[model samples]
Target: MFRNREEAAEQIAARLEHHRGSNPLVLAIPRGGVPMGQVIADRLEGELDIVLVHKIGAPGNPEFAIGSVDETGHVELNPGVERYGISPDYIDSEAERQLENIRKRRQRYRRPPTRAEGRVAILVDDGIATGATLFAAIRSLRAQNPSRLVVGVGVAPPDTVERIRREVDELVCLEAPAEFMAVGQFFQDFRQVEDEEVIAALGGESS
Candidate 1:
């Protein structure tokens, strides 16, 4: 419905202007969120950084997330994460693995951290699907004690939107599709966001 992701991001930037002037930090879920987050960083004259989160997948069916892990080893489980027959130790082990990935990504993305604690943390993503990643992203940001935690997405489902809205101080979403499927389905040019592009965006202070 929007002209594209950039236009959608720019609109979000307009609504979020107050935070920008107040030392707000924009954190993008890498690979996809970087581009949109970059536009926001530029408009707001704030700082841009990456917040890493890995989904805790269902046993055997690894693609389905039972929960998620943040860069700081924060674990959030679904109502019945125990139904997977996994132990606390096993989940901790997975958290360690994800933390390692987060480290690698931080190095690759140039390790930009604008002030996680006191600043407003505006988490961005190209879009939201099952809300698993976005859920993890918000919980992770919350642990950092940001003055405000916001979830910004180009699109999401209404249910996911409502749930996330409760957790964050603010939510700037362009579209809540009636029948949400994959995040890519809504984008006309939803290509894979490359790591190089993420690095380049980080290097120049996109915010």
Candidate 2:
């Protein structure tokens, strides 16, 4: 397992060095991804920003994501969503609710949204689990017409890696173990990342 998020970021940074002079925008999924994003921004000399995505949980099993919604109101449903027997009404209401939360988060963050029009967009998360949030985030980024879209993560399931790889221009993931169960399982210190930490990390150029 990796020592911590720092070590993971440093390693990912090495793989991302080619973007250093290209001015890629590193958008992180807070609150766990902020630290990793900060390290990437420092190493690549890129600007740091946030991409807030809220998971649309399955009915009765809130931890299990049926889909996700990004800050821009773009929703991504899992291909297996219908098998879960979730109704369209529930998905609509849940998406609206999560969008409101994203609204509040952006307001609380108080940072002007980054312009993704002509630059490469790199979305970073601590890791991927169901891949719902990252999928939504990638779709949203794609809508902005970025020159390119990339995904960087510390670890993920092999299936998830393959699924996301097709969606982005580049995928820089450190590990995709066959026996993976959760993102935290690959980290030596996988603690809860708080909102305060996210805010502080964004306030600085790097962490």
Top candidate (TM-score)? 2
Least lDDT summed over 10 consecutive residues: which range in candidate 2?
198-207
> Model 2: per-residue lDDT, tens digit, 1-207?
998998999999999888998888999998899899999988998989999889998878878888999887888998878887788999999999999999998877767688788998889998998898999898889889999898999999999999999999999999999998888989999989877777777783322
Name the Cα RMSD for model 2. Answer: 2.1
lDDT of all the models against the reference?
Answer: 0.81, 0.89
- Number of clashes recorded per candidate: 1, 0
lDDT value for model 1? 0.81
- Per-candidate TM-score against the hidden true structure: 0.90, 0.95
List where candidate 1 sits over 4 angstroms from the true fold. 204-207
Worst window of 10 by summed lDDT in candidate 1: 198-207
User: Mind giving the per-residue lDDT tens digits that candidate 1 earns over 1-207?
Assistant: 655668778988998888767767889998789889899988888788888888877667778887888776778887666766888877788778878888887877776455579878889998887777788878877777998887788999898888888988999888897888888777777777888888888884332
